[model samples]
Target chain A: MDWIAVADVVAAVLMLCGAFLVLAAGVGVARFPDLLGRMHAATKPQVLGLVLLLTGVGLRVHAWDVAGMLFLVAVFQLLTAPVAAHMVGRAGYRTGKVDTSLLALDELTPDQEAAERAAQDEADGETEQADADPR
Target chain B: MSPATPQDAGWWARWRHRMRTQWHAALWLMVVWVLLWGGVSVANVLAGTLVGFLLISVMALPSIDYRGRVRPVAALRLLGFFVRDLLVASVQVSFQALRFGWTPHGAVVRVPMRDTGDLYLTVTSVLTSLVPGTVIVEAHRITGTLYVHVLDLESSGGADAVRHHIHELEERVLRALASDDELAHAGLGPQGTAVADARAVEAMAGDVDPGAPSVTPEEDRP
Candidate 1:
């Protein structure tokens, strides 16, 4: 078989796999029962599937620079997807939007709690100290 | 005007601060522009840089603060967990959709937000809505509660399963982001408990119909 034919086959396989992953993510987006669950579907699959699809396109086109650029695009996506998710999640939390029933662990640190308790104790202690020192 | 002296230092400092912030935003924008165009052409580069600079300058004009925040590492971990869950849920959803044909025990579940911020709430809502069968029908900002519709709940599992699943996801997000106090103080935990309680009551009252379809077959088909 010619090299072009081989490349075509490889590209087809990669494209199929990429399509499958994207479809899987779409299924996830549809099937997951909550917002957090849906995010799970959208972010992960879209990132990886798009990368794979772009890679297949690059292979088919056989342009090294185009492939390199596509790789950079993937890298940028990899870097930014989580950041966007973080920003969105933080915004959601601040806005008082969350699904509490789906959570398994609390995210607060002990130091934070201790600090709040200490502040309260200090306030109470100051009140007692003032009462005792009053002439 | 008199020759500048130490009295002018405040103005200099403020100007310096603004410049610093603008430079940072501009640099980020320029990098993004270069990636977007993907060419060494001077015209493309210049145009992109100019656009980036303008956008950054406008954005920096606002006193938007992104400080005193949690680190990004924690958020990455959360993303990892979410991906894993997504894979698992995808399999389950696909199986149910193909084999069982979209008949699910559906319910309107109320989820409480961890007091992280408005950003988190919006992110969570969009994320959840993107999931195939779940949708955010209503959100109570004052109460920090989210009402979501779930698909494909096991009939025998009842509302307890729904409550448990919701709590589990919430806890996962909180732990992933180190947001316990914010969540607890925001009454997310209690709200979850309340959902569990309500589910229990509904179960006892026989109000939950097991035959409800989560998504119709037409909807599940690609």
Candidate 2:
């Protein structure tokens, strides 16, 4: 009975901490200035928060099936959240939501510009070939 | 995953080759299957094996070969660091979120990864993004650069500090994953120090220069 009580106490503490982290994440998304900044707020904290909450559930429930499912959920969240964050971040960058003036330094713009120039050159070469071929 | 034998081989031979080469993936899928059902049973294992094999045959993705040996000690250390970083970043971001009237400034700094493998690049990028303040915005495959968006640019000790931090993480990753030859090729000793103290000093020096330019030296670019 004491063991159960201890587990319950631990679970309650974990759940409380997890709730606070998720609340921080929520506030971050609402308060952050840029699209990219908000993306950080949306994904990162929620990941740890979800893990904590799932762990609390695992301890509170104390069953193998629930534990297994919770483990899978945590692993999947770790794997997928970054990919989702990256997708949103890349898209936000390309769509000009990133707000460059607010940035301390920007290296992606130069790379993007360089890639565009290279693509332009390739297009020009193809155009010249078309002109020459009379196709 | 690479096929152990070419497709021109007979289907039976190919299947056998795949069975040998992709046992790990199958095992992982089996685990996933069992977990999804929230139980481990003989029937679940058999069915999961069948489904995993079937999926492998159906999926024709590009093959990625990892030529690194896993160092258990280094890998565990990396995991420890990752957990510590996760906690540190979580607290910092939470503080930033709760603080009033302070809009955080971020930077998109391209950090060159010394290791040349796609596996290393992908792993490092995923790990970097999983940490709270940093998100991988773009990756240039040819130059092996990751453009990371940092949540607190000044607090991150500026671009150079962030770059060094990622490079250090990448080194830990390579230490965990890369073979000796690969490590040497990346200018890291098996023990994770540089060929000389020069690189370490350079990293240390860069940490002091907050808001440094985003330019890599011409030699480092390629």
Candidate 3:
């Protein structure tokens, strides 16, 4: 077996798999039930897909500099993607974008409702301040 | 500008503290800069370091508690488990989306973390979302609760499984990043009741256990 040819085949497989994952992510986002689930679809497969694609490109490039840059991209993606998802999910939940009724079992709503009740008992100015600030 | 003046003393101290907290980010940016420039030379390294420090200092991040020690063995295991779960869940979710006539059942679970610290809670939350099956809907910092939304019950193995997985994930994170003292404080080591103790303290501090069904309002607030 030609070693170079074997390496090329592996790279090709990685790229194809990466492409497939991105496609799957698109479909999942389109089909998932709620905003949070769609956010999951948007982040989950894309992370692995980006890593795999970067690895494949790095393999084919055969240069340390470009490969290092690709590695950085992967690392940054891994670090930031979930944080972005978390922010989006939190926003979606707060803005009433997430359909709570669609959820089979919701532990969050009860707490949220409870919090709202507690807020109602507070004086008017403090209630407005609580609504404005997450911290 | 001058470090010798009395006014400069506080400024120098503050700058040093900022550097101490921001050195990791600065170093990471410097490495990225050197790599992107392709091939490291003395000039390239110097320039990268200068740019990294300048950028970080100008856009300073809020300081985080950086007291944890990275346990190589536990960190490696956590990485391995994370990657395995990532692969498995991504494949399963991808296929589940592709399958016809099979609607997924989703649920939201509240997992109260053992470790009350923000760093431990953060790492666990990041890992949970990165793994594909669960997305955190809400995270209460004081109470140490993460309200996670699981994509599919069948794929995710139900609410109890999700809770177990979250607790286990938190444990792994605590092992990887938390110091021994912090671990013991979280109730993971030989002597532990920190979670309960922390919750009790928080409850006393006016933070009620809102999500826990078993804990009554009377029990938490008083």
Q: Which candidate ranks first by TM-score, i.e. highest? A: 2
Please report, as a residue range, the 10-residue window in candidate 1 chain B with the lowest summed lDDT.
B213-222
DockQ of 2: 0.52
TM-score of each: 0.49, 0.89, 0.84
CAPRI verdict (incorrect, acceptable, medium, high) for model 2? medium
Q: Mark the 10 consecutive residues where model 3 chain B has the least summed lDDT.
A: B213-222
What is the TM-score (0 to 1) of candidate 2?
Answer: 0.89
lDDT (CA) per prediction: 0.54, 0.82, 0.77
lDDT for model 1 comes to: 0.54
Docking class of 3: medium
Candidate 1 residue lDDT tens string, B1-222: 122223457755645565665666666666656666665578866877788666755554643333224537646755775566555554454444444234344455545554555555555665554334444555555445555555543432554444444444554455444355665653445334764455445534644343554211211111
Maximum-lDDT candidate:
2
Off by over 4 Å in 2: A127-135, B1-4, B192-222
Q: How well does candidate 2 score on lDDT at residue A131?
A: 22
Writing each residue's lDDT as its tens digit, candidate 3 over B92-207 gives 87887777677777888888777458888888988998888788878888777788888886567566567767766777788788887887777666223665455334433533
